[model samples]
Target: MKKLVLSSLIGLCGLSLSAQNVLIGEGSLLRGRGYCEPSISINPRNPDNIVAGAVLDAVFYSTDGGESWIADTMVSSFGVWGDPVLITDTAGHHYYLHLSDPTGENWSSEEILDRIVIQKSTDGGQSWSNGTFTGMAHPKDQDKHWAIVDTSTNAIYITWTQFDDYGSENPEDESNILFSKSLDGGETWSEAIQVNTIPGNCLDNDSTTEGAVPAVGPDGTIYVSWGNRGNLYFSKSTDAGESWTEDKVIAQQPGGWDIDVPGVQRANGMPVTICDRKGRLYVNWVDDREGNYDVWVMHSDDGGENWTDPIRVNDDTGSADQFFTWMCVDPVTNILYAVFYDRRGLEGNHTHVYQARSTDQGESWTNIRITEESFRTNPLVFFGDYNHISAYGGRVRPIWTRIQGLKMGVWTSLWEESRYEGEKD
Candidate 1:
C-alpha cells in the first residue's frame, strides 16, 4: 500500500470534513510510465473493489478501497490511444472505454482513429478481454467519451464527440455529439446516433460540441448535456436510446464552455449530469459569469424540461479560478457533492482540490478544501480535460491529476462520512 500522503482538517461548527489523501502511483508501469486525465469507479456490487484508468493505455486497480493500487497496462486488438473512461455495471463487471489507433498509423493516415473501443473485466480489472468497438466512422475522430450503466437493465450507454476532421480549421469540417448503447455486456452495441440538433466546428474548441456525458434517471430515462457557442443544452430519451428530444437550452454558459486558465494548456466548462434517488437531475460545470471561473450547479425538479438558475458551488468570492468540476449524488443519502481544482486561497499558479456539498438540492452549499498541499500545472504540458468522482454509502472518492514539477500523477481524497464528527478531534 502507498503511504498516507496528507490529511485535510476542515473544521466546521456543525459539519465534519475529515479527509485523507493518497497518491495512487507516479511513474509506475501500471500507469504506462506517464499519464494524466484519470477516471475512477467504485464498484456498486463491492465497494472495496475500485478501478481507475488514465490516458495512453494505463490502468490501476485496488481491492482495498484505494489503500494501495497495482498498476497494469490495457490491451485491445483495436489499439488503445488515450482518453480513458472507467465505468461499472450492476453485475460486478468493469468496463474501460477509450479512443482507438487500430492500424497503429494515426499520424501517417486518417484511418488510425477508426472507432471507440470498450474492454471488460469481471475480476476487478485484474485482466481484460480483447475489446469490442462502436462508432467506427473512418476518417472521423471519436474523442472525450463518457459512459453510465443502467443498474435496472444492466445496459451501458455512452456519449462523445465525433470530429469530421480532428483539429481542422476548415469551415467544412464539423463536430457533433454521438450516442450508443450496449445491451449484452459489451459484446455488441447499438448503432451510433446523432443527438445534437446543431453541429459545431471541428476545431475542438469552444465552438465544438463536446463533453456529452450521459446519466440514467430513476425511471430509466437517459439524460445528456453539453456545451457549444456559450450555451448549455439538455436532451433526454424516455424510451432508452431509441429516441431523443431536440437539444433544448437549459442555461447560458456566458463565455462558452472553452475558457483559458492561467496555468493549464486547455480548459472547458463541460457539464456533468447526475440524477439523484428522487429523480431530480443535477448538472455541474465551470463558468466565469461572476467575473472569474467558478463552479456552478443547476438542478431540475421536473425532469429535464426546466432548470433553475446557475448557483455558485464555491463559497469564495470571485477572485480565483475554479475549474474541472465533477459531481455525484449519493444514492443512499441523496446529497450532492462536487469536486474541482480551486485557486481561491492560493498564490501564483498553485491550485488545491475543493469539495462542495448541498443538502437542499442547489439552494445552498458548503465548500471545503480537500487537499493539504497545493500543486501547480504548466501550460506547456497537456493537463487533460476533467476530473472524476464516485460516492456511495457515505464513501466518497474524488480522483484527479496533479503535476508538481516534472512529474505528473493521479490522486484521490478518501472521504468517509463516518469519520466526520461535528467537532474536530
Candidate 2:
C-alpha cells in the first residue's frame, strides 16, 4: 500500500490545507476482529465532548474536540454483537445501540440477534449501562438498526429490519421494517410495530427490506426511508411513532442496496435520512446507475410528500467507485456535509476518504479530501458496513475504517468548516 500526506497533494497548487486525522481504535488479525462500521456523535450542548463506537464491543471518547481519544469495550446482559449506532440527545446524554447475542454462542445459538440492545451513557462514553432492549420477539432476528433523538422532547426513536429466519432460503420466511421509541430516556421503550407495507425475502440482499433511518421534521413529524427491491421507500409519522403512513416509493435504486465494489468484502447503498432545522428532509445513498458506484442525494421540503430528482454528489468527471457514504446536516448552520470512500483519481483498489459540503441546500457542492493517506484493501477482509459523520455548530467529525496490510483501524478527522473559508478547488 502507498502512503502519501494530504499536504503533498496540495503542494502542486502552492497551497496548504489539511485536516487532522485521529485514530480511535485498531484491530489485529487474530480471528479477524478488527474494528469497522464506526459511528460518531457530537454533544449538542458542548461541541468539545464527543463519543464514538465501532463493531462488536469497542467504544471511544474525546473531550478536546477530537484531538485525543480514550478507547474501551462495552458489555451488556443481552450481549453486544455488531452494527454499532451512536447518538446523543439534546441534554448531552449519549446512547449506543447494536445487535444482541444473548447466549454468546454467535451463529451456533438461535438466541443470537433475538432482539436489539441499547445502552446509555450519562458521563460521555467513559461508562455505560448494562443496556435495555426492544423488539424481543424470539425465534426472529433483528438487524440493521439506526436511531435519532427528538430534540424537542428528548425522546429517542429507532428503526430496523426484522427477519423471520435470518439467511433462510425457505420461501416462507420474510423480512420487514420495525419501529420503536423511548419516551423516558432508556429506561423503557414502546412496543415494536411494523411500518413497511411490502415485505421481502430473508436472503438479506436486494430483495430484502433494509436501511430504515428515521429523521425528525421541524414541526416534530417523524420521517423514515428504506430501500426495497429496486426502489427507495418513504413513510412518515405525524403523531410520533404511535402511527405511520403507508409506505411510498420516492426514488428508483437501479442497482438496489446491495452494491459491488472492488477490494470490498461486502457493501450496500443504504439510504441515510436527515432533516435540517428548517424542516428540509434529505436522503443520501450510493448506486451504480451510471455504470459505476456514485453518491447521490434527494431532498423533500413538504415532509416526504414530494422529492427532488437524484443529485450526484461526487464532482469527478470519470467513472470511479464511491461507497459507504454517510451525511449529516448541521443543526446550528443547516449546512449539508457528506463523507465517503473515494477512488476518483486512483486506479485499481486504492481508496481515499473525501467529504462534500453544500451550503445552498444541495444546489451545489464542494469536495475536500480529508484523509492523510490512501490505503489499499483486500476483498477477503471483513470491512464493516458503514461509516458516520456528525456536525454540531461548526465542528465536523467524520469517522471511517482504514485497512493497511492485515490490520484494520477506525479513524476520525478533526474538520471544521471555518478552516477552509478561502480554499479553492
Candidate 3:
C-alpha cells in the first residue's frame, strides 16, 4: 500500500487527510452534541470508564471505556463553564469533576448563590453528589470557575477566581482567587480563603480581567498561576492554603496592542499543567509574546525554585496561530504530548488541531497537525490516552466541535491503537 499524505482541503470538511478510521462519532452510540460544545475525559481509575459534560448541564458517562456511552446525572446544583476539569486518582477508583456557573446558575442559596463549586463521582461518572466549599460567590455578572486536585494527602484542594465584568474600577479590584480544601470527600471545605488578587492598576480598566490555575503536586505542594496588570505570576503553599509564599512572575507578555486580539489574557480559559513522576512541574500557557498569541511552556525542575526560558510548542511557531491548548503525559514513557488550536490555513481563518511530542524532557518536539478532517475550520483538539501511555499508543483521542448549518455539532476522533504514537523522534 502507498502512504498517502492529504495535501488538498475538502470542500465540506476543509483540511486534507490520508488515513485513519473514526472511533466514537456524533451519530454513534455517543449522543450528538448539537446544543453546545461538550468536553470528554476518561476516568483515571477505570480504563473502561469515560465521562463527558455539556453546556446543557449534564455530564455523560461511558462504562465500557469510550467505545459506548450513557448520560450520567447532571449532579444536584452546579453550573458549568466552557471546559470542565476531570480527574481520576492513580488507582482509577476515585473520579471527580469541578465546575461552576459562568452565568451563576445552579448555585447554592446560602452562599453567594452563583459561586464556585465541586462535585464528586465515585461510581465512575454514573451519578454525583454536591459538596460545599468556603461559601464565597461571585459578584453580579461575575463568572466563577475552579482548579481542583486530589493531593498526596488524599485531600481535595480547589482554587478559583472571583471578580466582576470587564472595565471595572481598581478600587473594586474586581478579581481575586479563592481557595478551599476537603479531607472527607466533598462533604466539608476549609474556611473560605482568599489566596491572591490580580494586582493591576489599569486606568483604562477597559476590558481587563484574569483568572488563576491552581494544581497540587504529588507532594501536596499547591502551585497557582495567573495574569494580572499586564503580567504573569505564581504563588505556592506547602501548608494546604493555610499560608502562601510571596507571588512571583512566571512570564508576562508585552503590553499595548500585543495584549489584544488572540492575546494571552489569563481570562481566555483554564491553564494546562502536568507534573512528571519525578516531581518536576510543567506549566504551559498562550501569550502574545510573539505579538500574537502563541503557546509558551515553562518548567520548574526544582519545585518552583526557578523556571526555564519560555519555549514555543506549536509546529507553526512562525505565526501566532496557537491557542486553547491542553497537554497530557504518558506516565509509562514520560513523553509529553500536547494539542492546540491553530489558524494558519490559506483558505480562511480556522482553529485546526496541531499535535507535538517532547522526548528530551520538553527540549525538542515533532509537531504535526492532527485535524485532517475538519472543514468548517476552527477544529479544537483534546489529547489524552485512555490507556495512560506517553508514546501515543493505546487509544489516542481528540474532541472537536464541527460547525454545521446554524448549529455547531460536537464530534470526536479516536485513532486505532495500532495507529497510536507512530511518529518517531
Candidate 4:
C-alpha cells in the first residue's frame, strides 16, 4: 500500500501510473558524456521518427518519439568537447542531420567551418554520407556558437562570434559578432559580415567562452542574443545578414555582490528567440531575478519593434544556478516551453534540468521540475513536431548530458504536464 501511494503521487506528477518523468533507453548515451551538449531532431517528414546526439561510438535513436530508443551499436567519434547543434533539412525526400563535429584535434576541430559536419540519414540515422560542409573558417578562438537558417529559396544564413575587430583578448580589447550567408543551401557561404558593429565591445567576457545563440524569426528577421558583462545584447539582421542594425541592449541584470557571494554570475545570459503563432516575437534567457540563476522572459507583439518588461520564471532566487537551456513554441496552440539545467540538488553547484511554460504567449510562466534527476550541464531541448503538442504537453524532451571530471554521457527527461490532467490538450 505504501508503494501504491508513492506511485500515485509520482503518476500525479507526470507518469500515467506507468511512465516516469524521463526514461533511459538503450541505456543513457555513454559516449558524449561530461560537459558536452547533445541535440535532437525529428524527421520533418515523419514526427514519429527522431534522432539524438550523444558520445560517438554511441548515439541514440527513437522511432516512437521518446517512448523507446535503440542505441547505435557502431563506434564513431563526434567531437564531444562542445555542446552540439542540430537541424534537419529535407533534400528531395530524404532527411539529413546538420551536425557539428570538430574535424581534427587542435584548433581546426573547433573551427566553425571545419568542425561542423552534416550527415545524411536515408534510413533514420542508421547510416550517413561522407560529404561534409566546407568553406567556412573556424577562428583560433574556441569561444563560438552558430545557427543555420534554411530559407525558402535554398539559401542559408550562418552566424557565429569572434573577438572584436582588433581580435585581441586584452582586457582593454573589444569583441564583435560575425555572420555569413550560403545561397546554395549550406553548400557555399558568402563573405563574413560583422553584425554587432556598435562602438565599444559588443562581445562580453565570461569565465572561459564568448558567443551567442542565433534565431531567425518570420520574414527573414535574423536575431542573435548573448551575454557580455551582466547584461544581455541583442542584434538583428533586417536585410538578412547583409546589413545589421546596431546592438540593441535588451535587458541587463546587475551582478550580485552579496556578503556570502561576491561577484556572482549574472542572471541575464544565454538568450533565445522564436516567433509565435501570430508572428509575435518572444525572447527568453537565464536570469537571476529570483536571486538564484532562474529564468526570466520578455516579449514583443509587434515583431521585435518593442518588448514587454522582463518576467521571472523560476522561483529559485539568489542561489546563482541554472544552465544548458533551449526553447520552442507550439504554433497550433501558441504555448511556449523552455527547458534548461538547474543546480538545485547537484554535487556542490552543478546543473540539473528543469522546464517552464507560458500558456498565454509570454505574459506569465509556471516552471516545472522536469527531471527528478538533473545534470551538471545545460540540457538541450527541442520539439519533435511543431504541428502537434509534445508528448509532455508543451514540454518536449531533454537530451541531458552529465559530466564527472573527464568522463561524460547523456540522458533524457520528457517535460510532460503533471500539474493538471488533460489541461495541456
Candidate 5:
C-alpha cells in the first residue's frame, strides 16, 4: 500500500483545474508485461470507499476517496488471471470478475480461461470469497467480460466474448458474446447463453466479437453493445437473460476495434455501454475514422432502437491519437464522464490521460487533462487494452496506466464534480 503522490494544476481551455494524482500500484517492467488494464468502482452507499484492479491479479482499495490506496494480490481456487472488472452494488457489495487459471499453469494448461470467475467482497473490498463462476463451456475460452448490477432487483448480469478456439487462425473457429446472471448475489449463476447473432473469428482482433459491456436501463431492461466486423452492434434482453433481441448495427467502426497505437504492444477501440438515470443509453469507443484514433460516443433515448449521430468526445483540434476509452454516468447527478489516453499536444509515443465531462448528456464535452505530466511509452512494452473510471454522487475517480523510465504503474485522479462549474467548451 505504498503511496506515490503526484499533484498538479492543469490549465484546460483557459480554466485552471487542480487534482491530486495517487499511484495505486507499480512494478518493474518486463519486455511485454507490467501492470496495466485498470478498472475501478465506487460504492454508492459510501462514496469514500473505492476499489480498483489491474492486470495479473492486482487489487487496490481506497477508503479515503482516491487520496490513499491499499494494494493486494487476489487469489481464488479458480486461479485469478487478467481482465479484471470491478463493480459495486447499491448495498455496497463489491464484485471482482476475471478470467480463471485453475491449474496455475497459465497458457501451458488447458484449464486456463475455462470460465469467468467472480469473487464477492462484503466488507468494502477488504476481503473476498473463494469465488463462483459462469460461462464454463469446457474446451472453449472465455475472455473480455464486463458485468453490471441491476440496482432495482439486486441481480447481477455479466457479458463476455466466448471463443471456440483462442488464437486459432482456422476460418471455422468463431467468437460470440455470451451472457449470464446471478439472482442470489454471487452465490450461483444461471446457464450462459449466446446473445450475439453474428459471430467473428477467434483471432481476438478487429473482426472478433469482443468488448460486450452490459448496461441496465432505468426500467430494468438489460442492454449490451460490442464491436464485430467493423460494426458496433447493440442488443437488449427485456425478459432478463432468457431472451435477447436481434443484433442491430448502431454505428460503423471505420477502422474496426483493433487500433494500432505507437508505443504499445496492442490496443483496442472496443465499445463501452452505460445508461444514465433518464434511460438514455450511451456507448463510448475509439476508432480511426479520421486516419487517427479518437473517442466517439452515441446516445439512444429510446432504449437501443434509435441513436443520435456520432459525437467526438476528445475535443482536440489536432490529429493526435486518443484510444482506450471508458465511460460512466453518475446516477445521482446524471453527469457523463469518460477517460482515455490522449496524445493531443505531444509527439510520438508520449501520452497523457484526459477526462471529458458532459453535463448535458452526450451532446457536448469539456475535455481536461488529468495527468500531471506526459509519459513516454515504448512499443515493446505491453500497455494493456483499456482504462476505466467510476463516478458516484459527485465523486469521480479515473484510473489509468502510465510508463515512466520503462516501468509501468496504475494511477488515479482525485477528481470531484465541484472542480468543474459545467462550463461548456
Candidate 6:
C-alpha cells in the first residue's frame, strides 16, 4: 500500500498525491558546487529503460523503471559545458547533446563555442561515442539546444540559438534560431539552416532569440517556439526542415523570458514546445503576467497557425514566484505534464517542485506538489536555467536541481500515475 499526503500547500487549494520521490544525484562525483539544467527521456520502445543528463558532466540511467539509478560521468572530445539534452530515436538509441568546449576552458577562445556536439549510445546510454557536431561557425556560440526524433522515419531534428558573439553588446553582433537534422541515426548532420526571419540583438536579454525546442506533428511537420522581447514566436517546416514558414507571434511573455526571483542568481521562463500524437500543439513558459511569476500554457488544435490564450497552470492564487518550467506530453495518451519550481507554500526563498497535469487537453488542470520537503535557494550560486520532465507508459519522471547546506544536487520523483486510477484528469 502507498501513503497519500494531503495538505493545503497550493495556497487556498488542497493538494494530495502519492509520489515516490527518488534522489538521483549527490555526493562528490556531481562535480563543483552545483548541478542544474537537467534533461530526461523515456524509451518509447522500452519504457523500463529511462535515461537522464545534467549540466557540466552527469548522466544517469535506469533499466528497472527508475526503481534505482546508476550515476555516470559524461565526457566527449568536444567537451561538455552544461546544457545537457538527452533524446532517444525509434531504434532505442539514446543521444546526449550539449554545447561544445574543445579545450575544457570557459570558452576563452572562439573555437570553444563554435559547435553543438552530439554523442550516440546504442546500449541504453551505458556508453557514448566521441560524438558529431553541427553549426561549427568560427566565433559563433551555440547554446540552449533541444532535439526530437521522428519515430516514424528515425530522423533527428535539433534547434538552438546561434550567437554571433555570445554576450556581446555590439549592434553588429546578432542571434538567430537555427535548425539542423540527421537523416541517418547520429552519424552526421546537415548544414545549419537559419529558421527565424527576424534576428534579435546579441545582448543576451529578452530581445535575444533563444530556447528553440522543436516538435513533430502527426504528419511529420516540424513545429518550434521560442521567447524574444516579451513575446513568444513560432514557426514550422513541412519538408523536414528544408524550409520554414515566416515566424508568427504566438503569445505574450509580459516580463520576458529572463526574470528576477529571490534566492537565485539567474532564472529564465523560456518556452518549451511540444506536439501531441494527434497533431495538436502546446507551448509552455513562465512570466510575471500576473502579480508574480507563474507557469503559463497555450494550445492549438488546428496547428501552429492559431493558439489559445495563456492559461495559468499553477493553481495557487497567492503572489508567489513559479519559474523554470519544462513540459512534455505522453504520445500514447495525449496527456500533458509540466514540472517547475514552486514557492506557494514558502514564506521566503524556500522552493519546492510542483507538477500540473491536463488530461482534458488544456481545459482543466490539477496541481500537485511532488517534493517531500522544501529547500532554501541561494543567490550566490547558479541555479541553472531549466528543469526537465519525461513521461511514457504512465511512468513520469521530473528532474530538477536543488541546494541544501551549500551543496547542490539533482533529483526526480518516481511518480507512477496508476496510483490514482479514476482520479486522472
Models, CA RMSD each? 3.5, 4.0, 7.7, 7.8, 2.6, 5.0
For candidate 2, give the lDDT. Answer: 0.89
- Candidate 6 residue pairs in clash (backbone atoms < 3 Å): none
Q: Per-residue alpha-carbon lDDT of model 6 for 1-425, expressed as tens digits? A: 12111112122124445466666765332455566778899988899998888778778788877667777878888887878999998888899998888887765656776799999889987888999999888778888889999878999999999999888989888899999999999899999999999898888789999889999988999999998988899999999999999989998899899889988899899999998887888999999988799998889988877789988899997998898899998877778899999999698899989988989887778888888788988887878888999988677888899886856877887777877444444
CA lDDT scores, all candidates in order? 0.85, 0.89, 0.53, 0.50, 0.90, 0.85
Candidate 6 lDDT at 178 equals 96
* Candidate 2 lDDT over residue span 273-331, tens digit each: 99999998999999988899999999988888899999988897578899999999999
State, as a TM-score between 0 and 1, how close model 3 is to the true structure: 0.75
For 1-425, candidate 4 gives per-residue lDDT tens digits of 01100000122254232224433222222433222345666555565566665433244566665666655522224333333454555442122223344554533443432333334456775665553443234443323445544434445555555443324546555555667765654555576766775433433334212345566665767777655555666777777778877777677744411111122232225566666646677666654555656566788766566878887766565465664456777544567877766666456645555666777887777666655543343223211100112222333555655443444545555444443335444
Candidate 5 per-residue C-alpha lDDT over 1-425 given as tens digits, one digit per residue, 9 for 90 to 100 = 44333223233333366566778878788544678989999999889999999998988887888677777889899999999999998789999999999999999999899999999999988889999999999899999999999989999999999999999999999999999999999899999999999999999898999989999998999999999999999999989879999999999998899988888889999999999999999999988888899999999999988999899999985789998899999889999999999999898888988999998998999898888788987887878888999998889999999888857888888777776554321
lDDT of 1 by residue, 146-201 (tens): 99998789999999999998999899989999999999999999999999898999
Each prediction's TM-score versus the true structure: 0.93, 0.95, 0.75, 0.72, 0.95, 0.94
Better of 1 and 5 by TM-score: 5
lDDT score for candidate 1 against the true structure = 0.85
Q: How high is the lDDT of residue 139 in model 4?
A: 49
2 or 4: which has the higher lDDT? 2
Residue pairs in steric clash, candidate 3?
13-374, 13-375, 14-375, 44-92, 45-92, 48-65, 330-390, 351-378, 351-379
| Each candidate structure's count of clashing pairs | 2, 0, 9, 23, 0, 0
After aligning candidate 4 to the native by TM-score, how far in Å is the CA of 397 from where it should be?
2.1
Best by lDDT: 5
